[model samples]
Target: MASTGDTVQNLPVEEAVARGGVTEIEKGARDSTDELRHYQSSDFASLRDEIHKEITSRDVLLRKLEESVTRLSEDIAPVKDYVMAEMEEEDDDASSSSSDTPEDGAPQDGDQETEEERNIRALNRCVDVMMSLTEIRENNEEKTKKVRGFYEKIYKASPLTSLMLKFLERNGGVKVIIDCDSKDISNLVRGLANLDGEKCAGTTLHKFADFFECKVYLGGEAGKYQVWEGLKWVDKYHDPEASLSQSLAQMVMYLIFKNRGFPYKCDDDQCEKLYEKIAQEALQKMTSGAYMDYLINDALSMKTPLGREVSLISVVPGMLVKHGSQGGMRTLQEQVPFLTYFFMQHVIPKMRSIIN
Candidate 1:
């Protein structure tokens, strides 16, 4: 009962084929979309669950370390009490011996121990036992500190941390956002233009301006990061003439400290003060010409007692000079390795002190 026009064979060959192809293409697209949705829903959910479980495990481990430290503290309390008691008893005995004139006729009690003497002996034995336990408690406290520190390092290095950082950055939750200045952007564009030998530099600044949201302003060059000190926001700005190496070092140290629980912005007043102090110290050291002079004059030439050499200058690419300013002063690229090494060696210890 169907008309010949409804049948594919009766239609123009191209038209019939075109309609069939379009239907196939549409069906394929729908299938692909369905697969993508399923993959996202299932796989992403599973991944999130895995990350949650890992975070929970790390937290449990940290909690255990805290509990161990608490138990040690509790155990050490009795030792502290016993030590105090012994000190008081010794003082009392010293006073009694010094004040009491032995009655010449009194029976000498040296052969047999008096109740007080026996008590003192017992106290001494208890003190000995407590001292041993105190030692153990101290060792455990140290180990707990070490374990907690290791856990932090592991957590910071984990993929979850990477994911969290990415999420924060994308959501504009980052405490510090460094915007490239006009001069920097222009320089970058010119450099790129030189590489490409193109006229792309003309529109580069305009394109960058249009790309960012209207609320954002980009300018200035500083080797330091912005931090939060309690309710106050502290901007640690460095010299504008600072090298790229200095900026790289600053960023690296910031990330390292951030991972070590020294977040740039925080609500805790103590943390804010500590980080602010650290930030100021870091800025001073990084920008100090005196430090550079010291590194070149003293630190670089130092050798081990056995005559084996140990120096960061040796690791740099070019031949280093010990005498002239040309040899002493390094290029921007040359400064990267030594500056990074210097920050890691000097600043990291300060950061580590707060880890516990």
Candidate 2:
């Protein structure tokens, strides 16, 4: 945040914010010991001009490339037509010269068939390559346009999203929420989260927003995505027991305790043993309405953490049944054909990970 003599740069955001709002950087950090100069509007204008020139050049290049490819394709069309015509001629010649066809009226020479197939595959591959290049060029052009727009919009909208993205880029496993809509930034977050060691521990919300008690925040989501650290996701309908809102606090506490080496007022080993005992007791008590009546009402009222946990897990097996249209019970087991299919619809895996 320190400045060199006669050097200019964008004002640090903290200095701008502390000045009472996002204005008056000079007054905000006026008490600073280090010398500084405001980055002049003229300098930003010059930078803008330079960046615009670069984009213009790129657009021109892309336009030229597209035209050139079109022209090349046109020039190659005659050759392609000629090749196809020659292939047809060869096929006709083969049929005439080879042993007469039977009822099927087709030649069955294995050697001729193999040679023709090789030629066709080579020609098909060449066409496929051309098509692939065309698609790449088109997509690049579209993406370039979107990126340019994103840069413009980032400045026009809030800078909070950009700040979160940079933080998450350096430190993985965090996410954030922001009011702005920028595909470029959203895509960046997705790529980061998809990278190894970057995903959150659990919760389908996909990213972190400075959720309640997670981090400090200034403004609200303004109906935009709830971002975690830098990850973006839409909030969806979820039952309280199955939702991140209900579970994130537990995850936070667990992470805090775990990071501190599991320090607590009680024995960690006993905690595990207690959970095991509860699970055993719940299984022993499983029955119809065991999910709600026996386990939840009977076990939890025993007035202990051990009692509550065993009762909680007892509800899990009941989730496997989904109601039919006429209200008959059908199992998720028969409905989900694959592990992935089950994984998406079932909360058991997420619950298991978060609970433990």
Candidate 3:
């Protein structure tokens, strides 16, 4: 019986020990699971916040870009329209203007012109005038004035000034100048100096005059030579790369001696004095704003000649100058034609021998 009591007590103790071990293991597992879940939740929240912030920033950037593009397109719209209109062919205008068949008896697309084509035509007109320089000089006074008035339009409205240098170069050399402005005998003298890049094949006389004759003409005591000396640079007047515009400006300077006419082959001491006087006058006029003022005031009005309804702003935009507000560089460019006519009509007679 004593042995049976001992067995019962030992059995109870063993059962209790097993129960406690199982409970402790289950509690440890539960704590571990809860800690893992808490850590995972915190990490996921941080990742989600970062993703949301990135998406919001991208959205704001996209909106700002859209607004900037809208403003830019609006700003360029007028310029775009103007360019398209200018580039459009004249077929539409011609078809609308005359319902009657063209003189050729049928509509010809090739006959229509764009703004560029019209400019080319005007450039051709300049070529025609240049070819007829001698005949024009012999023309009667009234006819000459009419011709002058007509050509004045070509210089003012057309891109002839910008295109003149290149065009003259391609379609033969100094001949273009001779044909275009016969009255401007001044150009005859000055034009010879610029034939270095011209197509003057086998023209020994022109090359000789270009190198030797015009050198003396431009190298007078107070002329281009002295101007070069003042600038402290070697004179490149005869350099092949010399600019046509500089040659033109030099012609303007020589115009002061128009009363006496340019001495192409002459060597009188009086000619030397005249060169100095003209140089001083040019410097003073350019520095004192007189040259600019004259150009502004005397520049031709393009409003009436281009068309009945054309405005000055349409022809030349961004006119900041006060007097010639209608046309800026466009107006200044007209000086080429105006000076050409003046030199031809007024100074040619005095230097007829030089031209001949």
Candidate 4:
């Protein structure tokens, strides 16, 4: 070994370098790279834990969404079912009516009804109207009209002629008189009542004389007194002297009397009774089917001059019927069908326009 090593050393550096000088250095570099490529068990465990966490989070979110959807479906299901049942009943009724013509050409009774049964049916119809009232309040104008029509149909079909009489009496403490017999009041002089003329001292007086069975001027001390008396009667509607139509007339007068200007031409002094006169005028305007616009045009414009800006819907909070207030009962529009009908038709349509 000494001889061979000594001979190689002496042989010259260039001839020895040609054989395999850097093989060990190359082997050491390859071994270090192989060591670094090995993955540890702890790293694999950490990656698995992260994946599990993400899977659990996704599962929780999915479950929460499903629960929310389930709750919403549950809430709507009953309403859907009730509406379907009502539609089916109506269809059945329509089919039976068309198919069942009696032998004498008269409509046959689907079933014989007793007195108690008729009463019960009428009660059901009233309940249906009550339900539809809430429905109309919740729905939009287009849908509300359909719901209201259902209630109207029910009311028209009912045999109860004096429905408003008892309802007004119980809720509004007012009486409903079909034909009020007030004496002739047109021939009476304005001076006799000390009523304000068109050129009154404080506010110009508008002649409501023809509007009533008698002559009465609005926008004066007497008109205020009448309003007070009317409110008193209405607030205590159960009293022996409560008149629904009179109370409503007072409320309407109170709302618009301040905008005094002119009056509509009445046929005659006693042509139409007070309540009938007011209702007929309202009915005539209702033909256009927009109560608020009718009031703005027919009531406000007819009552006041063009420059006056009087709004019936928008008023001071004090104007709303509250406890000890002189205007009306707190819920005047709800109890009196006249007010209720007009208010809903106006307010609902206004709300829809605003939303759009």
lDDT of 1 by residue, 214-331 (tens): 1111122434445455499765433221221122222333343443222332355754443344333333444564244322222232233111011222212111211222242233
- Clashing pairs for model 3 are 129-179, 130-179, 130-180, 131-179, 183-344, 184-344
- Best-to-worst TM-score order: 1, 3, 4, 2
TM-score, each model?
A: 0.22, 0.19, 0.22, 0.20
Candidates in descending lDDT order: 1, 3, 2, 4
lDDT of 4 by residue, 196-272 (tens): 22332212222232223322222211112121332473121111011212223332322223222111113424312
Between prediction 1 and prediction 4, which has the larger lDDT?
A: 1
Q: Which ten residues in a row have the lowest lDDT in candidate 1?
A: 209-218
Model 3, range 59-106, lDDT digits (tens) per residue? Answer: 674455345433432433443343234324323455445544366666
Q: Which 10 residues in a row give candidate 4 its minimum summed lDDT?
A: 234-243
Candidate 2 residues lying further than 4 Å off, grouped into runs, are 1-242, 259-267, 282-289, 292-356
* Residue 41 miss distance in model 4 (angstroms): 72
> Which lDDT values do the candidates have, in the order given?
0.34, 0.33, 0.33, 0.32
lDDT of 1 at 5: 75
Off by over 4 Å in 4: 1-167, 175-297, 302-342, 345-356
Cα lDDT over the full model 4: 0.32
Alpha-carbon lDDT of model 2: 0.33
